[model samples]
Target chain A: MTRKRFVTLTLIPAIGLLATLALVSIAGAIWFSVMNRTLRSADYEFVGLHNFLRLLRDRRFFNALENSIIWEAITVIGTLTLAVLLAVLIFETVKKPLWRNLICFAFLVPVLLPRVAAAFIWRFLYSPSLGVINYLCGLVGIGPVEFLANPSLALISVAVVDIWQWGLFFTVILLKLLETLPREPIEAAKLDSARTWEIHAYVTLPMLKGPLISLTLVKAVESLRSFDLIFVMTGGGPGTATETLDLYAYQMGINMGGRISYASAMSVLLLIVTTMAFVIIWKAGKKWTN
Target chain B: MANITCKNIVKSYGAHPVIEGLNLEISDREFVVFLGPSGCGKSTMLRMIAGLEEVSAGHIAIGGTDVTDLPPGERGVAMVFQSYALYPHMTVADNITFGLRRQGNSRAEIAPRLKQVADLLGLTPFLERRPKNLSGGQQQRVAMARAMIKTPKVFLFDEPLSNLDAKLREKLRTEIRKIHMQLKTTTIFVTHDQLEAMTIADRIVLMRDGQIEQMGTPDEIFERPRSRFVADFIGTPAMNFVRAEIRAGDELCASGGGLTLTLSPHSFPDLVAGQKVELGLRPARMELCGQNSHNAIHGTVVLVENMGAEGQVITNVAGAEVSFVTKDFRSLSPGDPVTFSIAPDHIHVFDPETGRSLRKD
Candidate 1:
């Protein structure tokens, strides 16, 4: 082919892609501009900083914020640790290629399930009288204790469900990372006479640092945005238990129970917190991958 | 430090056999090299001896103790793999000390051994550096140090220098030979390079098709190969073979030759009158003989290859092409008429059907 035709062939698609991207970005810019204008013109009157300052004074907001922090902490830590453990277990145990693929496929089922559907399923399982857990406990001669109904158990119950639903997704991703890791290092560790525990502690775990940190940060972000399951299961019931920031935002913005601007402020705060977390994790992961 | 004996060793993957019953013995402090083409099962044999692979039907003994069923760690053997197999996350020091530490040796005992091996391998300065930070040669040295730290009974090398450049390979080959000589550890190395086998091994085991064709000293394997496979594999510009029939008459001669050569009455006397055979002659064994001389084969030189120190003359003889290696880079042009004769003592006779050398009295 002549150089002119070759240049035209290459540049045409590049130019088309650039034009399409520019047009899309312009549309997005215009949409954001219109939304900002609409938000400015809204009749929801608010005193300057009054919503944010009032959120600070609101006892339920404080309670929801505290619960949200604890929920995120528990979910992120529990999800990452359990997911990594499950990934490693499946990786080591599942030898048949088809079986391994099937297990990974099985783990992705929970992630694909709608959060509300999963919450409803768990709500039935966590029912005070008819729940399987209570029935099993009754086998041991225990009382039919309340799960989502009790304030003390409600947050923990919600966190457990979040972990169950999302832990497998992280495990699937981490299993991929583990599988693609260089086999030479593992073989080297074996030749070095490293026992299984030492191999996990010294070689495998250290090498998994990047994936582990990234998985934790991503799970943290996902957990912080937890909403649907809690909404379906407990509905922030039993006097503000399990009222995470996402629940708080939903309550204030859409529910008639709280102010709208204050929820927007809370969403902005969440955006800042997640952004900072991502930046920190990104920098650390970048240092490692480099 | 140890003698390794492999008796009728065999390895098979389910129905596919990798090494068909092999027997080999290495005396104490001998550097034995398993040299062969790829897929010839040399490395497989080495791994079998290292107890890394299960031996199907044989007893492998190192230092006169049966170790065929033992694990690699318990076999008193250390192997340097082709990939160097250095732990990427650990520093050179930790990598070298890992095996020793695993033996539950105290820190004091491990430190001296680690320091000794590190210093011996010139890895002291790089002890703190991780494997990825080290050069290829340095990583290889660290692998050697790691293997050597245990002072195992037998050292197995699985093409450890194949990943390096030619210059580094040569340098490391010499270093390994020196180390072997100084330490006097019975070593078995596997490589496809005959030159490396010739340079480092006290004995070379030439294998083909998952079987050892010949095992002898390098000079023996090079000079008096027991089979055509060994002859073709051991040398660079391999030996030339020509199909010829032994003639029956008052005097034995190659009848197809323009000028017939008289064979010694005592040589090849078991004479089945006219037998079809293949004549083997090393390139160096064919000398330039006078034209029209008896016992000389006349041919025309087709190509002259001058490779600096040696020149190879390719000639057409009896409708077949044959090469003659010479140190004298004569200005022989292509298509020049030449006559050559094989040195009677160096002429190898092989049974055409079996490809095995004929035993001559």
Candidate 2:
């Protein structure tokens, strides 16, 4: 076979499978969203824009939107900040390869835990009476604290769980990237009288801009679509305190109300926003790196 | 005021000692080149002076102040690295003034000084471009401009031209000397390139095995090498060595391989009869001569490396090949007989085992 023909034949299985799965699901969703489809009443009628208009007036949908924004913002910022801090600390301080690798592995153990398993683990840790965290808090004279129960702390508490899993995973990646970065500029900054913090803030962080932006976008998308951690930990509990858009859409369509068309509309909205964000971030990163 | 004194400086990595008990004094505004083979302690010594590498046991004083514990910036020294480590995201202007800006100088305070240094280094045109956009030579100038703008008491260059092409290296070498002449900073440059050391250094400190092998001016080093390593490391078409034996004649003479030369009696006063020595002859010092000329050696041409201005002719003499540079363009091919003569003073004598020059001062 010609090289081009062989390449095309090799790519067809993966490309064709992915394209078919995505197109069929999106077409089905679009079709269902325009009709008043419900599990309770199977005889559906075409009702254009009616479900979308219901979403516009739905108080639960607005509450889920607010919760998702807070969750994604806090989670992405916290994860990225910890990644930079830990990566720089280890890169600068840890001398031997054996120690560096061991430290990184300890932080990475959380990533090996399944998200559902991690949710259960965090739920126990946040328990007011049985948790060792509360026991330590008592030593500090602070709490029998309601970590997952209080309305103001529920989303942040869950966001911290996501941060714990992803932040260290990215720290290892950033540390490897730091190894590839030329260290002479940092040394030159030292001779320029840059304090240690100034060198990292001005020189090292600016150099890592491209990778950090890409990580930020990925973390944003992952936090927005997160559902299992909240499901196992709070079940969007304490009166919808941790109900993100993903969990709200699922609960509205499947559990509490069988409004499948409305959930499809919410999925479509999420897809559009994610694609726009990815393109913008990718473009800005390209401009900066080049 | 910026004269440097290093007293018994020693550097070690755990137990591996790199520099051991090295002591030297550098005068204010003196340009010294640390010349050596790779793995010699030239760069380590330079770093010790810059306070980048801490000396294990020594006292270092700069400008009459003990700066052994000071940082590089606080020691009033700046360095141009081998790789030209300019901040990639910063523009030429920003990089040049980074030192002043970091020291809390405002933009308006540094603008006039930056312009002056940029114009001095011919970097005014590239002041706004990033380092990635500039050529290798241009980036090197930016590194120099960064140092020059600081107006420090000492300038340390660690093989700053090793990355450039030949023509660019030569150009920058001359420009660096000119900068030294103009600024008169106490400069210490480290390079394994002997030509670079020869062209730019007011004094060459040739090092070997973590110690000073020889130290002198360029002409003193070339004319009177104190050891075999200095003669070999400091010349292009390096100085040739031939085994010889000292003989008692009317005066002391070195005779070997159908060649004999009258040695200066004042130079080799310790040499007795039947002493084995190595006769060192520079290729540039030997001249092509006629068959019957005095102090001439006869050989068969083994190979000829022909350049337009000058060429090196490798000739076989008594089972040893001796090469010499000749400006005499003749139609010479392999298997042809050749004769070359050397002046009596140009013949260097060294003890074969110790490799130390026998010439007494």
Best by DockQ: 2
lDDT of 1 at B23: 84
lDDT of 1 by residue, A220-249 (tens): 767766788888888888778888878877
> What local lDDT score does residue B259 receive in model 1, on the 0 to 100 scale?
37
Q: What is the lDDT of residue B304 in candidate 1?
A: 92
Separate DockQ for every predicted complex: 0.42, 0.71
Q: Once superposed on the true structure, which residue ranges of model 1 sit more than 4 Å away at CA?
A: A1-46, A140-145, A150-152, A288-290, B106-108, B249-271, B292-295
TM-score of chain B of each: 0.93, 0.98
Query: Candidate 1, what DockQ?
Result: 0.42
lDDT of 1 by residue, B37-137 (tens): 99999988988887666888989999999988876678888889899987777788988888888888989989888888888889989998888998999
Can you write out model 2's per-residue Cα lDDT over B1-361, one digit (the tens) per residue? 8999999998999999999999999999999999999999998898888877888999999999999999877988899999999999889999999899989999999999999999899999998899999999999999999988999999999999999999999999999999899989999999999989999999999999899999999999888999988888878788989888999878788889767877778878899999999999898888899888878889999998987898888899888888989887456788999999898778888888999999997
Model 2 over residues A200-258: C-alpha lDDT tens digits? Answer: 88888888888887888788777876799999999897789999888998997899789
